[model samples]
Every structure is written in structure tokens, then in C-alpha cells.
Target: MTKEIAVLGAGSWGSVLASVLDENGSHVRLWSYNEKQVAQFNETHTNPKYIKNYTFSESITAYHDLAAAIDGVDYILFVVPTQVTRSVARQVAAILKDRNHSVNIIHASKGIEEKTYLRLSQVLSEEIDPENRQSISVLSGPSQAEDVVTHDITLVTVASDNQRAASEIQDLFMNNYFRVYTSDDVIGVEFGAALKNIIALGAGALYGLGYKDNAKAALMTRGLAEISRLGTSFGANPLTFIGLSGVGDIIVTATSTNSRNWRAGNELGRGESLEAVIKNMGMVIEGVATTRAAYELSKKRGVEMPITSAIYHVLYDGADIKETINQLMTREGRSEIG
Candidate 1:
């Protein structure tokens, strides 16, 4: 019942997932490009830089060598940030290219790449070998690394067109504290995962502006509306937006202190400049990139997404956050149905 899982990337999410898999009685090869972090994990059993205070399972083998980390692995779980997905995938492909390994890949990160505007799954398809792409699956939901590392009850959806692939991933990830559900709608699940980060930024801005609960509530509701509109426009099931990856993801990202996107928005709302906020966060706020991608997606698909447009302007054009808010609020009133 044991499997080898190569976890590429050593960020908070990667460390947390490695801990989860190790606890679930799997051999986890926790690969980090940073040798120092790998040494830290091996010595202390804790990813001191990311998920602090919790010790990882001893079953985790931290490795600095990419090929060694992936060797003999049956499954690859990518926990790298969205921006780095391609680079990591390419490195992994080069290592696994020659071998006719029947490995399944699961991607946990969410975000569309800005310049190419390609989804994470798309990036994987392009970077990984064609044989491996058929076995690719995406795991996404309202889950956070901080909560998962502490063994908080978290539910996530593992989606792939291949039912067997989903079932395999669900078995690998399911445990007492973590529940995995399977869905066939990969596009829907992925879109929900990527787009919710944008709404979270909006919610964080409201919180930072001292807005009351009513304002926050309204923002979240409308945020979902815009996100679903965009998702459905692109052949994603509208119902998926109501599930874990959509509404569930939106609530967690918008409200949780662990959300990097929300933190960035809060800083912006508190009158800090976008550059200053990003510099302080020291991490990729996926929503920032998603905003630009979503804006482009909306224009290309003829779907209206005012919220994403506002965020994009504030982030890219040096527009004042307050001015962006006023622009949104002052838009010509129309029927909610329209």
C-alpha cells in the first residue's frame, strides 16, 4: 500500500503536503532546489523557513538532487508556485524523459501564467512528456498549508478526466484529517482555484478599509458572480463554481490570515503602494498575476469582469486603490441579472 511521491518545490504548501503524505505511510522524497533548506529539513524534521513549529514525518527524505528525488517515484506532486511550474516541470521532464515510467502527476498550485496566459495544467502539458500528461491530475480547494500542516480537517477535490487517476490520487491524499473528493471537471476545478485568489484580494482590501461585515459579505458574493461568469464563459461547468474549488476557495482565500493574496490586498488597502506590499510579502501573490490573466481572458471571451479589471489597473497601471474602488462603485447601475 506504500507509494513513492516526489514533491517538487519546498514552499509552505510543498512542505505541508510532504508531511501529509509521510504521515499517510508513503515514502516522500521532498525535493528542494535549495540545499540549505533540504539540510534544515533533514536535520530538524521541520521546514523552519515555511511551516514552522511542526515536525515532519521521518518517512520524508529531503533531497537537493532533482533526479535522485524523482528516481523510482510513482507519483509526482507539484507544490511549486504557479510562476515556477514550467521551469520545475521542464527539469522533471528531462529527468523522467528516457524512462518509461507510469507515473501520475498531481498539481496543487493554482494560477495562470501572465505572459502566456496558460493555465497550470496547460503548462504541465507543454512541459511534461506526452505520456505523462495523460495521467495528470489537479488537486485544489479551500485548503491552506498552515491548516493542513497542523492536521486541521480539510476537504479538497482531486479532478481529472481519467477516473482512475482521480481515484489513485484520492487514495494517496485521503486521511483522518484530510478528505479528498473526485471530480471529472479538470477545467472547472482549475479555474475556480486560480480565479478565487483575485476575489480574495478584493476581500482583503475591504477588511483593510475598515469596511463592515456587510461590505465584506457583498464583496464575496459578487466576487463569486464575476469569477463564475468568467469560468462558465470558458466551457467550465457553472456548478463547479459553487463547490469546494470555487465558493469554498473564495471564502478561505478572502478571509484567512494565511492567504498571501489577502495579505497583499490588506497592505494595499492600508495605503501602502503595490510595489511596497509585494516587496514585503516576499512571495508570489497569485491573484496579482491572475488579475492580468483574468482581464485578458474576459476581453478575449467577451465576458464582463469589472472586479478583475479594477485589480489589474491598480496593480499594473499604478492607479490608486481608492480611485479603482470609486470607479467600480460609480459604474452605471444595471440590473443584477444583466
Candidate 2:
């Protein structure tokens, strides 16, 4: 049977995922808040604004109307920026209140909320009525839209507390070029996904500063430790950190030039202002916001994330990159295990 799925957020990842679903024989409605972008997608079947060198699947319809896009769909996949998730959820909740059949909820957006500190799923659970939803899950890994759109082999994990929900999602996305794995560790997956971007920023800074492989290697190892430390503190399984959502994601995100967070950090390391980097990039750099959120999260939870702290200061406090690096190296020696 052909399934109908609503993919919210017409950005790079949304378009790519819609194409993936379409290729898997699902009818996909790609929704965007931008009317112009919707018209462009429906008319020209191209999206050069968010991602270049790719064409949208014409079989997938584009929608500016959220209710119309989602009506009667079996799934709603959110690829929106984390900051706007709450508002979008409220709208979805309103529409779903009158619906009889339940739709599964999933998000690929990675971030702990800035002020409230809620996960995107938590926000969805809070705003969306439970009776109207079947299960909430997250899809995350080291996927960059640029590579995935080109049909490079990609592996990602979709996690839900409900095993059935995870498997169902896996079936929808799995293909020759894209493989899906299922996990029950939503906390570890989400945290790992969100925290890695912060480390990737640090990694980008290292590369931009002309640091070589040694520095990159040290940063990645310690960054994983920091990620595990904070992740386990919240009752997330330690083993989850070594899985696709953890070390696997860290490897690609920290090393890939295709990462927006990496590119943003490279510009910052070259002494460009955050404003200029963001403006020139013309997209949301999730790490910039995640840095602030994680900085505060670590302090609130009493987790020692030195790399996150350093990047936080550099990003939010206007600290110099080299000086911060010096401070990090000069900190009193501690056990390697610590």
C-alpha cells in the first residue's frame, strides 16, 4: 500500500527525506512556511536556496498550508529549526485535535531548548494531544544533506520508546543507499546528535586555526567523553554513545566540510563576527544556538564539558579563540579518565 507522509520544513533535509520517501513509494507533501518557496518547489522542482546541485522529486507535492499538507497523513516528520518547534507543534496540535486517526510524530531537528531546556519531542508531547498521536520518535545521525542527496550510502538511527514505532519508521526510510537502525535510547540519540554539533564547531575552529590531525583527533576523543558524561548524567545508557547517534555522528560532523556548524566555526576561527558568518551562510547554524543551550545545560546539571564551555564563551561571551585554546591547555592537569 502506498503511504502518505507529511514532511514539515522545506529545507535541505526535508527535501532530501521527502525524496527518499518518494523513492520508497510514499506520497510526500513537503511543507514550508514560505509561500514563494512552496510555489518554486511545485513549479520548477528545484531548491537551490537551501541546497544546490539537486532537483526536488516532482512526485512529491509542496505545500504552504500546514493543515492541508498534513491532512490524512500517517506520519509527520519535523525538520524545522528547534527554536520554532514549539509554535509549529501548537499549530499541529490544534489541527490534530479534531482528527480521529492518530499520526506518528518524528523529528530530525537536534537541540535542547535554550530557555526551557525541553527536547523537541518533549515540546511535541506537551503541545500535541496524546490521543491524537501514536508515538514520538527522532531520526538522527551524521547525515549532511549535501551527501545524502547525492545517494552516498548513509546510515541513521530512528529511536522511539515504542519498538513498533521505531521499526515502522525504519521500514519507511530504508533503501539501498539509506539504511535505518532502531534504538530505544531517545535521550542518548538526541543528546548525542545535539552535542556533536558543538564539538564540530570546536573541530572547525581547530581546522581554521591551521591545527593538524593531532588536534582534531584529541578534540574528537575528548568531545566524545564530554558527550557521554553529560548524556549518562541524564539516565541515558553509556553504550548508546558508541552507536550511530554518538561516535559515528561525531566522526562525520566534526570532520566533514559539508557541515554548516563546521563552516560557521571555520569562519569564526578566521575572526569573522558571528553575525557575518550567519548572514553569509544564509541558514540556521544549529550549533550556534546549541552552544548557548548546552553551556547552560552543563552548568545546570554540573557536567564538566570544557570544549562546550570554551566554544560557548567564544560564541556567546566574545572570547578570543586562541586565548580560549591556551586557557584550555593550561588548565590544571587531571586524570585521563576524568
Candidate 3:
């Protein structure tokens, strides 16, 4: 049976996911906030501004109207930026309430809300009424849009407290090239997904600052340690950090130029102003905001997230990058396992 799916957001990741669903023989309606871009995508079957030179399937339809996109869809995929998730969720919830409809919800965005410090799934639960929410699941891992579009072998975890919902999403997304795994550890998966981007920024900064492989290795290793420490504090399974969403995602994001967070950090390390980097990138660098949220979370929970703290200082406090590195390196030595 063909599934009717509405995909919110038409950014690079959203567009690519819509295409993948189209390939999977799903009836996909992709919604974008920008009307002009929606029309351009409908006409050209391409999103040039985001994913250059790649054409979407003709079977996929683009929409600017939220109601029209969600009309009669079986599933709704939220792929908007993390900061805008609450606003979009409100709109979606209102529409669903009015229509007396509920659909399975899947969120692909990765970031914690800055002020509330809530995970995307938590934010969705707050905005969307329980009666109007069928089930909520998160899809996260190391996969990149650029690679996935080319049918590269990619693995991701679909996590939800509801086992049936997680299994359904895994079936919907799995293919020969795109592998999906199911995990009940939603907290671990989500935290792993969100926090890796922060470390990716640090990795990129190290590269831009002319640090060698040894430094990058140390950063990622210690980054995973901190990620696990904080995640487990919130009742997450510590073993989840060694899984795909944890170590795998960090490896890809921290090293790849395709990561917006990494690219933003790279620019910052090369002496570009944060404002200039944000303006030039023309994409939401989630780690920039996630760093702040995680920093606050660390302090509130009294978790020692030295790497996150250092990056937060560099981004928000305007601390010298070299000096921050020195501080991290000179911190009192401790055991490898925290």
C-alpha cells in the first residue's frame, strides 16, 4: 500500500527525504514556507538553492500551504529547523485539531530548544495535543543528504517509546541503500543526534586552526564521553552512545565539510565573524544554538561537558579559539572513562 506522507520543511534534508519517500513509492507532499521556492520546486522538480543540480521525483508534489500539505496524509514528517519547530508544531496542531485528525509524527531535525532546552520530540509533545498525536518517533544517525541522494549505504535509528510506531517507521524508510534500525531508547538517540553537531563544530574548528589528526581524535573521543555522561544522567542507556546515532553520527558530522555546523566552525576558526558565517552559509547551523542549550543543560545538571563549554565560550563569549584549546588541553588529567 502506498502511504500518503506530508513532509514539512523543504530544506536540503527535507527535500532529500521527500525524494527518498517518492523512491519508496510513497505519495509525498513536500511543504516549504517560501512560496516562491515551492513554486520553483513544483515547476523544475529541483531545489537549486539548497541541493544544487539534483532533481526530485516527478511523483513528489510541493506545497506552500500547510493545510493542503497535511490534508488526508497518513504520516507527517517534521524536518524544520530546531528553533522553528515549536511554531510549526503549533500550526500543525491547530490544523489537526480543527480537522479532528491524528497522524503518526516523525521528526528528523536534531537540536535542543535554546531556552527551554527541550528535545525536539519534547517540544512536539508540548505543542501537539495527545489526542491528535498518533505516535512520535525520531530518525537520526550519521547519514548525510549529499551521500544519501546518491544511494549510498546509510544506516539510521528510528526511536520511540511506542515499539509499533518505531517498527513502522523503520519499515517505511528501509531500503537496500538506506538501512533503518529501531531503538526504544529515544532519549539516548535524540541526545546523541543533537550533541554530535556541537562536537562537529569543535572538530571543524580544530581543522581550520591547523590541528593534527591526534587533536581531532582526542576531541571526538572525549566528546563521546561527555555525550554519554549527560545522556545517561537523563536515564538514557549509556550503551546507546556507542551505537550508530552516537559514535557513527559524530564520526561523519565532525569530519565532513557537508555539515553546516562543521562548516560554520571552520569559518569561525579562519577568523570570520559568527555573523558573517551565518549570513554566508544561508543555512541554519543547529550546533550554534544547540551549544547554548547543552551548555545550560550541563550547568543545570552539574554535568562536566568541557568540550561543549569551550565551544559555547568561543561562540557566545567571544573567547579566543587558541586560548580555549589551551584551556581544554591543560585541564587536570582524569581517567579515560568518566
Candidate 4:
């Protein structure tokens, strides 16, 4: 059965995912909030701003109308930034309510909401009506848009509380170049996806500051330990941290130049102001907001997240990067695994 799917948010990842679905023989309707972007995609069959020099699949159509995008789609894949997810979900829910349609919700965007600190799935559940929402799932791992579009081998995890939904997503997205693994651990998958961006920020900062591979390796290793600690406290399986959504994601996002969070942190370490880095990047850096949320979350949960705290202070509190590193190094030493 060829599934009719609506992909919201025409950013790099969204555009690439839509193209991937089209290549997999699904009819994809890509929705963009920007009318001009929609027109551009329709007229040129490409999104030059995000995915440069790449044309979209002919099976993919672009839409500026939220209702039109949701009209007959069986699944809605949200790829927008986490901060704007609430507003977008409200629009989706309204359209679904009026049409009396139920569709599975799948989100590829990552980041914990700042104030509520809710995962993207939680945000969707709260905004979308239960009757209109069939199930919610998340697709996450080390896959990057640039690499995926070029037919590079990519693997990701699709997780949902509903096993059937997860399996369906895995089937929908799996292909010769892309592989999908199914997991029932929604909490662990989502947290690993969201939290790894924070660590990537630190990793990039270290790189920008002229740190070598040894420092980067240590940051990633210790970073995973902290991520597991916080994630376990919130009812996630500790083993999930060692899997694709955890270590796999950290390795990619921390090291790759394709990561916006890493780029942002790199710029910050290279002595660029946060405002300038954000303006220059021309994309949402999920880690910036995730850092703030994780910092607050660590305090509220009484979970020790020293690396997250150091990055937060540097990014938010105007702490010097060097001083922050010094502070982290001078902290009381403890066991490698506590």
C-alpha cells in the first residue's frame, strides 16, 4: 500500500526525509510555513537554501496550506524545530478536528521544551486531540540530512509506545541506503535524541578551542555517562544509552560539521557571539535551547550534569570558555562509573 504522507517543516531534514519517502514509493506532501519557500519548491523542484544543488523527488509536492497538507495524508511527519512544535501541532490538530481524520504522528525534530521541559512527543500529545491522533512515534539516530540525501548509508531508530506504529514506521522508512530499527523505549529514544545535542555543543566547543582527539573522545565518553544518569532518573532504560539513539547519535552530532548545535558551539569557541553565530547559521540550533532546558532540568531533578552546566554557563551566563573548562577540570574527581 502506498501511503500518503504529509511532511511538515521544509527545512533541510524535512526536505531530505520527504525525498527519501518519495524514493521509497510513498506520496509525500511537504508543508512549509513560508509561502515563498513553497512556491520555490513547486517552481524549481528544489530547496536551494537548505539542501543546496539537490532536486526533490517528483512524487513530492509542496504545500503552504496547513489544511491542504493534512487533507488526505495517513501520516504526518513533523521536522520543525522543537520550540515551534506547539504552535504547529495546534494548527495540525485544528485541521484534523475539522476533517475528523486520525493519523499517526511522527516527529524527527529534537529538543526538550524550555519551560515545561516536555519531550517533543509530549508536546504533540498535549496539543493534538486524542481522537485525531492515532499514535505518536519518533525517528532519531546519527543520520544527517546532507549525508542521507547523497545516498550515504544511514541508520536510525524508530520508537513508540505502540509497537505496531513503530514497526510501521520502520517499514515505511527502511530502504537500500537507509535502515530503521524499532524500539519500544520511547522515553529513552527521545531523551537520547534531545540530550545528545547538548553534549555535541560541548564537543564542538572543545574542537573550536583547539582541543585534540583525546579531549573530544573524553568529552563524548563522559558525556554519555551523564546522559545515561539523567535519562535513567526519568525512567529510561540505561541500556538504551549504549544504543543508536545514545552513543550513535552523540558520535555523529559531536563530530560532524553538519550538526547545527556543533556549528554553533564551534563558532562560540572561535570567539563569535551567540547572536552572531545564530544569525550566521541561518538555522535553528537545537542545542542552544536544549542546553538551557537541560541545565534547569538537572537542577530540578537533582541530577549531576557538570558538562551540561558548564556549557550552559558559557552559552547563557557569559562565562569565558577557557574559565569554564578550567572549572570543569578542577571539580572534585569521582569514580568513572558512579
Candidate 5:
């Protein structure tokens, strides 16, 4: 049986996922708010603005109207920016309430809510009416759009407390090139997803500041420790931090120049202003906002996140990069396992 899937937010990642779903014999509907982009997709199956030199699968239809796009679809995958997740989810809920439909909701975006400090999955579940939501799951890892579109071997994890729902998502997305795994540790998976972006920024900063491999090695090693500490304080599984969503994601995002967050951090490390960087990048660099969320959450939970603190000060408080690094390096020592 063929499944009908509606993918919201037809940006680079969303477009790539839409293509993958269509290739797997699913009827794909990709939604975007931009009418011009939708027209471009329908006419040429190309999104040159965001994804250069690539053509989307012609079978995947693009929609400008949200209601029409999701009409009768079995699954809704959100690739929208983290900041607007709730508004979009509420809109989805209103539409589903009228239709009396329940659909599996999944998100590929990573970031914590700036104000609420909730995970994107939590935000989605809170907004979508229970009657209209079959389940809320998250797809997160080091998976990149550019690589996945070219049929590069990519592995990701989908997580939900609902075992059946998690397995269903795993089966729906797995293919020869793209492999999927399921986990019940939703909290850990999400924390790994949202928090790793901050560390990636720091990694790129270290690289930009003329630091060599040893600097990056220390940053990542200690970075994972901070991520685990904060996450476990909030009821996440410590082992999840070692899995694909945790260390695997950190390895890819922090080290890869393809990552928007890494690139932004590179610019920041070279002494550019955050405002200027954001203007030039023209992409949602999630790590900036995620750094803020995690910084605040750490204080509230009394969790010591030194790397996050340094990045937060640099990004939000206008602290000098070198001074922030020096401060972090000189912090009081503790046992490695502490």
C-alpha cells in the first residue's frame, strides 16, 4: 500500500526529504509559504535558490496553501525553523480538528524553544490537538540534505515513547541508501539534537581562531560531557548521548563546513558581528537560538554547562571570543567523570 505524506516547509532539508519519500513510492506533497517557490517547484521541479544544481522528483507536488497540501495525507513531517514550530502546529491542529483526522507527526528540525525551553517535539505535541495527533516523533542525526539527495549512505534515528509509532516511522523511511533506527529515549534524542548545534558552533570557532586538531578534540570531548550532564538532569538516558543522535551528530555538525551553524561560528570567530553573519548567511542558524535556550535552561536546572556558557556569552552578551575561550580553559578543574 502506498502512503500519502505531507511535508511542511519546502526548504532545502524539506525538499530533500520530500524527494526521498517520493522515491520510496509514497505520494509526496511538499508545502511552502512562498507562492513563487511553489510555482517554481511545480513548473520545473527545481529549488535553485536554496538547493543549487539539483532537481526534485517531478512526482512530488508543491503546495502554497497549507490546508490543501495536507488534505488526506497520512503523515505530516515538519521541517520548519524551530522558532515558528508552535504557530505552524497550531495551524495544523485547527485544520485537522475540522476534518476529524489523526495523522502521525514527525519533525526533522533541531532546536529548543527559546522561551519555553521545551524540545521541538514537546512543542508539537502541546499544540496539536490530541484527537488530531496520532503520534509525535522526531527524526534527528547528522544527516545532511546535500548528501542524502545524492544517494549518499546516511543513517538517522526516529524516536518516540510509542514503540509502535517509532517502528512505523523507521520502516517508512528506511531504504538502501538511507537507514533508520528507532529509540524510545525521546528526551535524550531531542537533547542531542538541539544541544549539539551549540557545540558545533564552538567547534567551528576553535577552527577559525587558528586552533589545530588538539583544540577541536578537547572541545568535542568535553562538549559531550556537558551535553550529557544537562540532559541526564532532565531525565534523559546517559547512553543515548553515546548513540547516533549524540556523538555521531556532534562529529558531523561540528566538523563539517556544510553545516550552517559551523560556518556561522567560523565567521564569528573571525570577529564578525552576529547581526552581520545572520544577514549574509540567509539561513536559519539554529545554534544561536539553541545556545540561548540551553544557557537559560542550565541556569534554571542548576546544571553546569561551561561550553554552552561560553558560546552563549559570545553570541548573546557580546563577549570576546578569545576571552571566552581563556575563561573556559581556566575554569576550576573537576574529575573527568564528574
Candidate 6:
């Protein structure tokens, strides 16, 4: 039996998911904020804006109408960039409330809101009604849309407080090219998803400074340690940091050219100012905002995340890259294994 799934945003990640869901035999209604993307997808069955050169599956319907997209939807996938999640969620909630129907929401965006510092799941919970909150979940990992859309083998995790809902989502998205794992520790999943991007920026900065693999590996490993420590302080399972959403994600994002954050950091390392790098990317490099949020989160939680702090300083406080690297390297040495 096929399910009706509505995917918000028609960017690379959103389009990739629409293809994956349709390939799994679900009827997908993909909404695009860009009228051009919608027109292209509707007319040519191909999204030229993000995932070009690949046709949207015949089972996937592209839409520009919010209400029409949510009509009789079983599961709603919010794939919009992290910055716009709250706005999109508010719109969806209004539609759901007007229709007096609840839909299971799975957000694939990865970031902490800049001003509120709220995780994507928390943003949804606060914006959506209590009834809708019960069905919210998050899917995140090292999976990139460019790779996933090409049918590369990818592994990701789905997290929700409701185990049954997580399992249902797992069944809905898992395919030959993709594998989904389930977790009930929503905090660990969400924190790992957001914080890894900040660490990725730091790693990219290190690479931009002409650091070797050993230095990169050290930064990534220590970054994961601090992330786990901070997550554990927030009542999350520490072990999840060692899983796909944590260390696995950090490795991929920090090292891959496909990572916008990494690419942005590389430009910064090459002596470009933050403004120039962002203007060149032409999309929200989530880590820039996430670094600020994580810095605040660590201070609030009383957890020490040196790498996050360093990255935040470099990006926002005008800290020199060389000085930041020296500060990280000169920190009091600790035992290798935790």
C-alpha cells in the first residue's frame, strides 16, 4: 500500500528525498518556494534548480500551494533549510489545524536556530500543536543530497520519542540505496545533527590553514568528544554520538567537498572574508549560525566544547585562524580515549 507524503522545499535535499520516497512507492507531493523549480518539475518532471539532470519520478507531484500540498497527507517531511524551518512549520501547522487533522512530521534539516538556538525538533514542537508534537521526528546523518539523489548507498537515522512512529518512518524511507535506523533519544539525534556542522567548519578552517590529516583527525575526534559530553549533560544518551548522526556525520561534512560548510571554511582559510564566502555559496551555510547557537548552548549547559568555541570566535568575533588553531592545540592535554 502506498502512503501520501508531502515534502516541503524543493532544494537539493528536498528533491533527493522526493525521489527516494517515490522510488519506495509512496505518492510524494513536493512543495517548492521557488516558482521556477515548481514549473520545471511540473512541466519537465525534472528539478533544474537543485538536482539537475535527473527527472522527478512519475509518482512525485510538484506543487506551489501549501494547502493543496497538505491535503490528506499522511506524513509531512520538512526538508527546508534550517533557517526557514520555523516559518514553514508555522504555515503547515495552520493548514493542519484548519483541516482538523494531524500529520506525522519528519524534519531532515540540520541546524540550531540562530536567535532562539532551538533545535529543528524543538522548533517544530513549539510551533505545532501538542497533538502534532507527538508525531515529530528527525532524520539526519552523513547523507548528502547530491550523493543520495544519485542512488549512492547511504545510511541515516530517524529519531522520535515515539518508537512506533520512528519505525513507521524507517519503513517508509528505507530503500535499496538508503538504510534507516531508529532511535528514541531525540535529544542526542538532534544535538548531534546540529553540532556536527559547526565542528565541520572548524575542521575546514584547519584544512584551509594547511593542516595535515593527523591534525584533521584529532580535531574531528576531539570535536566528537565535546559533542558527546555536552549531549550527555542534556540527558541524551552519550553513545549516540559514536553513531551515524554524530561522528559519522562529522567525518563526512568536515572532509567532503560536497559540504557547503566545509567549502565555505576552505574559502575562509584561503583568505576570503565570511561575507564573501557566503555570497559565493548562494545558500545558507548552516554551520555559521549553528556555531553561534552551539556556543550559547554549551555555555547554558555548562559543557566545555573547545572546538565549537574556537569556531564561533573565528566566525563571529574576528579571531584569527592561526591564533584559534594555536589555542586549540595548546589546550591542556587529556587522555586519548574517553
Better candidate number, 2 or 4, judged by lDDT: 4
lDDT of 4 by residue, 1-338 (tens): 99999999999999999999999989999999999999989988999999988987766889998999989789999999999999999999998999999999999998999999999999999999999989999999998999999999999999999999999999899999999999888889999999999999998899899998999998999999888988899899999999999999999999999888888889998999999999999999999999999889999999999999999999888999999999889998888878
TM-score of each: 0.97, 0.98, 0.99, 0.99, 0.98, 0.96
Give the per-residue lDDT of model 6 (tens digit) for 1-338: 78999999888888898889988889999998877778878889987656668877777888999999989989999988888999999998898888888889899998889778787898998899977544989999989888998889999999998999999999999988899999998899988998888878877777888987998888888899988988888788988999999988998998998888888988888888999999999887889988888899889878888888988888898889898888877889888666
**Clashes in each model (backbone N, CA, C under 3 Å)?**
0, 0, 0, 0, 0, 0
Per-residue lDDT of 1-338 in model 5, one digit per residue for the tens? 89999999988899999888888899999999899999999999999877889988889999999999999999999999999989999999999999999999999999999989999888998999888988999998888788899999999999997889899888888899999999988899999999999989999898889998999989998999999999999899999999899999999999998889899999998888999999999989999999999999999999999999999999988999999899988988878887
lDDT of each: 0.87, 0.92, 0.94, 0.93, 0.92, 0.88
Clashing pairs in 1: none
The digit string of per-residue lDDT tens for model 3 on 123-236 reads: 999999999999999999998998899998999999999999999888889889999999999999999999999999999899889998999999999999999999999999
Off by over 4 Å in 5: none
In terms of lDDT, the poorest run of 10 residues in model 2 is: 93-102
* lDDT over C-alpha atoms for residue 286 of model 1: 84
- The pairs that clash in candidate 3 are none
lDDT of 3 at 286: 94
Report the alpha-carbon TM-score of model 4 versus the true structure.
Answer: 0.99
**Where is model 3 poorest over a 10-residue stretch in terms of lDDT?**
329-338
Give the C-alpha lDDT of model 2.
0.92
